[model samples]
Target: MDDDGVVPLSGGVMKAVRLHQYEVRPLVEDVPEPVITHPFDVVVRVGGAGLCRTDLHIVEGQWAAKSNVALPYTLGHENAGWVHAVGSAVEHVQVGDAVILHPLATCGFCRACRAGDDVHCEAQAFPGIDTDGGMAELIKTSARSVVKLGKGVEPAAVAALADAGLTAYHAVKKAVPLLHPGTTCVVMGAGGLGHLGIQALRAMSATRIVVLDRNEEALALTRAWGADVTVVADGSHVATVLELTDGKGAEVVLDFVGERGAEHDSWAMTRRAGSDFVIGYGGTVDIPTIDVISTERNVVGNLVGSYNDLVELMVLAADGKVEMLTQTYPLDAVNDAMDDLDAGRLRGRGILVP
Candidate 1:
C-alpha cells in the first residue's frame, strides 16, 4: 500500500516545485492534484507555503536518510490556503474556508494523539517532508490538521506560523515557568524562527528578552519587536550574554540556530539550573558529564507544535499579539527564494504562493 496519507491521486494536474535530486535545484513542474481518498482527507487550494532552513537542509541531503523521502517530492512544510474540498467525515472545515495546516498529519487514535501531544503520534506523516507538500496549486491533508483563519487574516501572511512560528511558540510555551518576572531569557538567532520566539516570549511572560544574531538587521528587527537587548553574534556573544544577565547568565535560553557552534553557546548562556531549549536542528550537543550534574542545566529538544499549539498561536495572531515579517514569491520563483534563505539574505520568512 502507499504510505499513509499519500494515496493515489484521483485525477487532474497542478503546478508544483519538486526536488528531483540532492545538491540540485528544484524545478516548478506540473504534478497530480490532490483529491479526497479517505473519510478524513481534505484538499486545500494552495495559497502559500513557507520556505525554511529545513527545506535547505532537505535540498542538501541532510534529511535524506532521516526523512526517507523519495526523491522528487514536493518540498514545503509550512502551509496555509483555502479549503477546496472535504472528506465525508470531516466536519471542522469546509469548502472556501481559509485555514493553516499543522505540519504533520497524525492518527487520532495514537497514544500521543490522545494526550494532545500529536507531534509524536506513532502513525504521523510529515507533509512537505516525506510526502507531497502544499507548494503547489492544491494539496491534501487530514481534517485534524486544518485551523480555520479568522477574518482579516490572509493565508500567505501567516502561513509560516504553521511551522516556524509554531515551533518557537511551542518552545517558549514550555519555558514559561522559567520566565517569570525578573528572570532573563536569551534568544539566539533573530531569524525566521527566533523572531517569533521573541514575540511569543514577550506576549506570554514578563521576562526581559535579550537577542543575539549574526545579522545586524535581524538584531534591529528583533529589538523593534520587543527584545530588551540585541547583541551582534561576534566572537564574544557568550560573554556579552553573560554580561547582560549580570554575569549569572539567562534563566532560559532559546537556540533557534543550532549549528556552527551555536549549540555550545546556547548551553553556555544558560544560568545554572536554567533550561536551554533547542529548536533548530543539524547540530551536535556535547557537554561534560560532570557539568550536567553540577550545574543542573536542562537541555530541552523541541519539535513542531501540536494541533492545539497551532490553535493557541492563531489566537495570539488574531489578537494582534503576534506578527512575523514575511516576504512572498510566486511558486515559479522557488529557486530564488531558496537561494535567499541559504545566503541569509531574506530578512524574514519567505513564502511561495501558487
Candidate 2:
C-alpha cells in the first residue's frame, strides 16, 4: 500500500510534491506510484496539474480544519492525464485514453450522485484537498470521476478546466436564462475564472457583457474575450454600470472576487430582480431580509462543478470557443509556480507538467 493507504503501483517510487505540514510550503519528494485497488478504480499518468488559489489556502491553514486532511499528501486538484491502468470493473475508458478528472470522487449510490449533482455527495472525497491527488507522476481515481477528453483537446491545455473553468461555466450556466439580448450582465474580477465566464456568456447568450476589475490587464483580456464594456473596479464602477444599463442596473452580477467589499459593490449594481452569483470565497454575504423581499433578488453560491459539466466544458475547448491561457512549469518548479500565482505575476492558469 502507498502512504495514502491505497494500492501501490509496481514502478517503485515517483517524484511528487507533498504537504509535510499545515501552514508550510510543500516539498517535492519521491513517493510510491498509485495503483488500482477497488474493482472500479483507475490509475492515470498525470499530464498536467493546475495550480489554483485553493491550493494556496490549503498551505496557509485555511483549509486545514475544513478539509480535515492528514499531513504528507500530494496537493493538486485540477488534474488531467492519460489512463494508465484500470480495474476489471472499469469499462468505459481504456488504457492510454486522455482524460480530465472531476475534482470530487463521489459514490454513485448517494442521493446527490443519483440526481447528477455529485458535488454534494454524501460520501465524497476531494482530490488534493482530502486525499492524494495528481501532483504526483500517477494518481488513483474512481471511474466515475474520469471524463475522456474530446479530440483536438490535450490534457495539459485544458487541465485548468477541471476546476477554474468549470466553476465559471457552472455559474454562467445558471445565469444564462436570466440574461437575454437586451439584458445587461456584470462580471466582477476578470481573472482566470472571470475571463472564462466572459467567453461562456458570449457563447451561450447574447446579453451585453460588462466586466469590472482593478487590474488593467485583466480588463483588457476580458474585453478581448467579448465583454461589451469594461469598467475599472473603483468607487464609481457601479455607477458606470448603472449608466450603461440605462439607469436600471445590470440584470445579473457574477462576483468572482467576493473579498474586500467586492460583493457589496456587486450587489448594488444588481437590478431589482437580478441574481447575484458568488463564486470566489474569503468574504461573507450579508443582505438584509427586507431587501431580499422588496427586490426579490437572489444570492447564489457556486461550488465547483459536476462530471457532466466538465464534459460540456471540454466540448467548448475542442471547438475553440473557450481557451485557457496556461503557463507551463516542470514538476520540479511546483513551488515557483505557486509563488508566481500568489504574487499575482501569472496572467492565466499555471500548469505543472511531469
Candidate 3:
C-alpha cells in the first residue's frame, strides 16, 4: 500500500475473492483495500454485493479475450454500501451516507457523455471486470458513480438493482415510448435480470406485461411481481404470445436469454414494425436479411443503463413501487451461492454480505 496518510486510502486493508483462470473457482484472500485515485473519488464500506450471471460467464472465460481484466482480480459489479470516506474534491456525498454503486466509470469528456449517453462513453472502465470490485469490506468509487439510497431501501435489495435492475431499466425504457396502454410487452426469461425487467416495466409503463420462462417456479414468481401473463417457453410459445396479443403480435419484445431459439421466438412473436431488444450477453443468432427489410422490424442491443437511469430506478424502489427479491449469503459461502445460481436452485437473486 502507499503511504499517503489519507484516512481511506492509506493503511487500508480488506478481504476479497479473486479469479485466476477461466472455468476455475475463485479464491478468497486478504488484499489491500481500494483507495481514492482521483480528487472526486469516495470510499465505501460495502454492506452487500450481488452475484450476477455475468460473473458466472466471466468465470467460464467467455469474456476473457474481450475484457481487459487479468487474472487474480476481484469479481463483483452489483454493490451497495455506506460511505466510509470521501476525497477533498467530492461534494455530492459525505461520510456515513448510504449509497448504491454504479459499476461503469465513464469519461465525462467523451461524445457519448456530451449527449448524456454515458453508458456508451468512449472511455469506459467496468468495476469487477476491468478493475477491482466490491466483494470486499471497502471499495473506492467516483462520486458520479455513487447514487444515494433513499430512506427505507434495503441495502441488499439495492445491490441487486445496481446492474441487473439498471440494465433492465434501460432496455425496457427504450421500448416504453412505443408500448401504449393495453399493448403487450413480452419479456423472455424470468430469472435475475428478467424478473427485474418485469418489475421495471410495471413501474414505468402502462403496457400489459407477458413473461416467458422454461421454469415453472420462475414463471410463478413473475406473476407475483405483477406480470399480466406468464407462458412456458416451449416450441409453441410464439403462437401463445401472438394469440395473447390478439394475433397482431406483441408491440415490444425484450429477450433477456439471448439464446438461439429464444431469439427466433422473439422475432416471430413481434409485430411488423415492432422493436426487439436483446439485453443478455451470451449466445449467437442468425438474422435473415429479408425479415429485417420486408417487415421493418428493428433489432436493438442494449448495454447497462446510464447513471441517471440508475437514480430513477432507486426512486421507484424508494417509493415501494418495485420490489427487489433477493437472498443473502455470507461472503465465505460465495462458492455455494455460485453453485446455486448455476443449478437454478436459488429462487431469487443472491447477494454476498461481507
Identify the candidate with maximal lDDT. Answer: 1
TM-score list, all predictions: 0.96, 0.95, 0.95
- What is the C-alpha lDDT profile of model 1 across 1-354, one tens digit per residue? 244554545679889989999999899998878777787898998889999999999888998998898888998999999999887778988799999999999999989999999999999999989999988988899999999999878999999999999999999999998888999998999999998999999899999999999889788788767899889999899998888888999899999999999999999999999988999878899999898899999999999989999999999999988998999999999999988998889987999989
Query: Per-residue CA lDDT of candidate 2, range 1-354, in tens?
Result: 644455644656899989999778999999988867677889889999999888888898888888898898999999999999997778999999999999989999989999999989999999899999889898899999999988666899988899999999999998999987899999998877888888988999999998999888878777678899899877889889989988878899999888889989888889899889999877788888999999999898999989899889888888889999889999999989989988878877999999
Residue 27 displacement in candidate 2 (angstroms): 1.0
Better of 2 and 3 by lDDT: 2
Task: Please report how far candidate 2 places residue 185 from its true position, in Å.
Answer: 0.8
What lDDT score goes with residue 37 in model 1? 78
Worst 10 residues of 1 by lDDT: 1-10
Off by over 4 Å in 2: 1-11
Question: Cα lDDT of model 3 overall?
Answer: 0.86
- Residue pairs in collision within model 3: none
TM-score of predicted structure 2: 0.95
Q: Is candidate 1 or candidate 3 better by lDDT?
A: 1
Using TM-score as the measure, the top candidate is 1
Query: 1 or 2: which has the higher TM-score?
Result: 1
